[model samples]
Target: MAHPQPRTETSSDAALIRAWQAGDEQAAAELVARHARPLARFLAGAGAPDADVDDLVQETFIRAFRGVDRFRGHCQFRTWLLTIGGNVLKDFGRRAARRKVMPLDESVRDVTGDPHEHAEASEVEALLAAGLKQLPRLQREVFLLRAQQGLEYAEIAAALATTPGAARVHYHHAVRRLKEIVE
Candidate 1:
């Protein structure tokens, strides 16, 4: 007989959102704890400055909770939260652009240990960052959602307000563009 699989916190994000909607404060905390890391990763991959990632995550959660009542469950809660994060990041970018103070060199974190490996990793990261920056907003968001967040095209479409077919096309275009840029 096969053993039953254990349930993970990831699978319960929707349940946590429901609990929070019902006025469960602990559930809100749990959702934040469960999603914070992934959201941070997504934000960083989308080119949020290292110094602003924590603030961006906080802002994303703030907006999500404030608009929680509007969440209609069309997508996963994490996807919805990330959609809010993308908007937050876009607004932040626009503000930074207006100030003519955009920063792109802050995404590479210092890695300890072997010097050669670190150099190679940093080079790849830089190339990817440059490539991502060149993509159109929809392609960038779709690529990050599908590639980095491991979301399905359907989930990405729901989050980005596009059709699944369009999401797939955007992701493919992003991949093709990145490959050309890298090569």
Candidate 2:
């Protein structure tokens, strides 16, 4: 009996992109599987209210697929996807800011815990979210991309449409501001 060899997972993103373009649906799935959680984390940590995180992640993938032809491999695929995600977040924030009727999510208090502990944790989280909201969008994105997403300065720069040097500066400023916030 002949047995098939197991496939290796060493394919570069470029190769995966090519495969996806050639109608190999698994390649798209692989890309999404590899990146989706990180995108969600980045979105959440970058000031996306928790309720909107999943939708924003889905929208980022949708936009990336639709605009894949414009991707020139000038940077890593994850970097390009973060750029798309960042744009989506910016647009969402703008629309949200314009709409004064937006209602806050009422489900958070449903969790089981000592009310005082939960309230304290919620207050701290709200303060951190507010601090992130106060940062210039670039600094916030750079900080989350580097600190939370574990991207290198060059990758963060590419994702945020800036120089690596500028990314470093943004990260420093963000850290200082966030420390001021938490302290």
Candidate 3:
């Protein structure tokens, strides 16, 4: 490999991956450090609870590093990482679904403060959460990727393994439903 360029926030992920492949551990750390925030945001927006987002982010990177050989240059690295994260959360949801539901006060409550106790923005956020939960999984994921993460439809399509046209349709449906619910 050519002289490794200085690692910075702006360094291309492909370059970081190449250095990592060449045995530079720091390159891997830089990759995680650079993208972890965005990955966490995506996870949170995709319906991961506050308590679980950190673990999900770590697992996403672990899977990515272990499966690096399989990563084709089909999408941006962050997009790929988000895809891994969505899978992790899906698996977690599946396991949780198998367990019996517990009453909110008995089984568990969100560690984040009371969902009901809040001002205007908080109320709006709560409403949005309820609306999001009602969306079909694909529509919810598409909406979050496009609206919250600011990804283009092509990137969202790549991450979600759908066509760009389908992704666009999902986004429109999600927006219509959320508007009906939130407003």
Best by lDDT: 1
| TM-score, one value per model | 0.88, 0.82, 0.85
lDDT of 2 by residue, 1-183 (tens): 955333248877887887778787888888898899888888877777777888999999989988899998877898889878989998888889898536354335366778889888877776777788789988888888888878899877766668999999999999899889977
Clashes, model 2: 0
- The C-alpha stretches of model 3 lying farther than 4 A from their native spots are 101-118
Model 2 misplaced regions, further than 4 Å: 1-8, 101-123
Q: Higher-TM-score candidate among 1 and 3?
A: 1
lDDT of 1 by residue, 54-91 (tens): 99999999999999989888998899999999999999
Question: Which pairs of residues collide in model 2?
Answer: none
Weakest ten-residue segment in model 3 by summed lDDT: 102-111
What's model 1's overall lDDT?
0.87
lDDT score, candidate 3, position 180: 100
Instruction: Give RMSD to native, each candidate.
Output: 5.2, 3.8, 3.4
lDDT of each candidate versus the true structure:
0.87, 0.82, 0.83
Best by TM-score: 1
| Between candidates 2 and 3, the lDDT winner | 3
lDDT order, best first, reads 1, 3, 2
